[model samples]
Target: MAHPALKNAWPIPRRIVQRTRGHGQGFITRLMSPADLGQALKPFVFLDIFDADRAMLQAVERSGGMPIHPHSGVATVTVITQGHARYDDPAIGAGEIAYGGVEWMRAGGGVWHGKEMTAGDVSRMQGFQLWLALPPELENGPAESRYIDAGDMPYAWPAHIIVGKYGDVRSPVPAPDGINYLLVTMRPGESWSYAPPAGHSVGWLALAKGMLDAGSTVSAGEMAIFENGEAPISLEATGSEDAVFVLGSAVPHPHPLHLGHYSVHTSAEALAAGERRIAELGQKLKEAGDRQTASGSVPVFR
Candidate 1:
């Protein structure tokens, strides 16, 4: 049975440990960084939310979506909440990435990618790019990538399972165990509550659009981190329009974080190994010459 979304659900609703509107750069907003939130919320590291207009899209098309960049000891997950992204690639063919669609890349040992996605017909494109610190075993393993359309994603009513299980439904994003990421849309005045699974003490939500009453008002672009505990989080859509947000909860990462330009690892040795692999791949990418696809996008390079 579902937990009731009753008004004033808990006398002491899950408290908001902290809230902030993260740093912004042009069309993108940085919600959390490894140096900051990653210490508190491990496995879950960096997050960037972006809104691209026609001008922005044109600029991307000119220079390629994102400059070819290298990542090691991390997995990047891209999900769209509004509009869509177009991709013309050999692996996935041509398609539009709307809400619920995802571009998941596990930059295990090392990988360079940034042109795998392009702007679609939509005038404005909005979504998020999240980075997860990998475990020791997979952190230096093999790299992998996948593009799944919205229709193929797992859905349970108001919740779109992006990376983990929701009730009986599970996402196919190949995420690590002990983490759950969901894109939830709640109708005006609608209430919802999230009951974290066993041992999931890290919980937070970032609003993409509309307002949410999660113990306190969480406006668009704001992120609310819940106090550490097993308590459930109760929320309500306070705005007249639908409220859309991404919520995540996970077990605490057990190791210290070792960071590089675009990587996060468990130990200094792992970080060094990953950096070396990234350097090798970077050299190969340089040798691969003009690696842009006909669609003007660049594929993931390893």
Candidate 2:
């Protein structure tokens, strides 16, 4: 009664949690936050889906630049799913982050950044900005960052391993093991299955375009968080257009989240140390006269 590919589906749907849209500073939708679904899907916390079309770009350009900010005790992963984005990081140099490309920054201990990325010349830009909570060890260690081109990332048909291993391929992203993040694209009327690795019970997906039918319908600008289980999940493209989305799964973060003004840590003491380090770094940069730069490149304040 179904296509040949559908017959071998490894995972059936369990449950689907719809996205709760929220306001963003310069984006269309902010899917998850620390209070929303972040607790349920720790290690993978915070997700913002933004559309960088002509109008959005123009608004950003007119508004000038974003201020330098600090983050700690977490790693931020940005993936460009449609069009491209430009970044000039002193640590990783200058490059374009197109589809499948990733910018991973672990704000362990503390660091100041956020003046490096901007919209490229493409007519439209769309992507996901995700934050992962660091483990206790890495959460208080030195900050690190990497800008990996799409070509360097592990490749698989219709799916790019953004965080963890897929099949025999492993992503170059230096992240904690057991977590899996994938960028998947499916053609119209196509069928696909994602068999998550063992112990990865937290599963979720956010679509950028077209429709994905996982028993429940998930359209663009929507995110679907699955129920708690280890069963494989099946996905089908139900729209005429191609389906573009990013899915992530992991064993829930073991530590309790200690929230800060702009950081997340495993404990209160860790948060205090992170905040103190950020303050010291900020002061040092201010005294060195290298805190702000008008160029496109951002100063990596260590």
lDDT of each candidate versus the true structure: 0.88, 0.85
TM-score of 2: 0.92
Question: Model 1, 232-287: lDDT tens per residue?
Answer: 88999997889989999999889899999999999999999999999999898888
> TM per model?
0.94, 0.92
Off by over 4 Å in 1: 1-12
Model 2 segments more than 4 A misplaced = 1-11, 290-295
The number of the candidate with the highest lDDT is 1
Give me the displacement of residue 112 in model 1, in angstroms. 0.2
Question: Candidate 2 on 1-302: residue-level lDDT in tens?
Answer: 78879877735556775555556666657788777688999988889888877887877777765677899999999999888878776556788889999988889999988766777888898999999999998998988888889988888977989998988999999998889999999999999878888899999999999998888888888888888888877899987899999999898899999999779999999999999999998888788775333445565677
Task: Give the range of the ten consecutive residues with the poorest summed lDDT in model 2.
Answer: 290-299
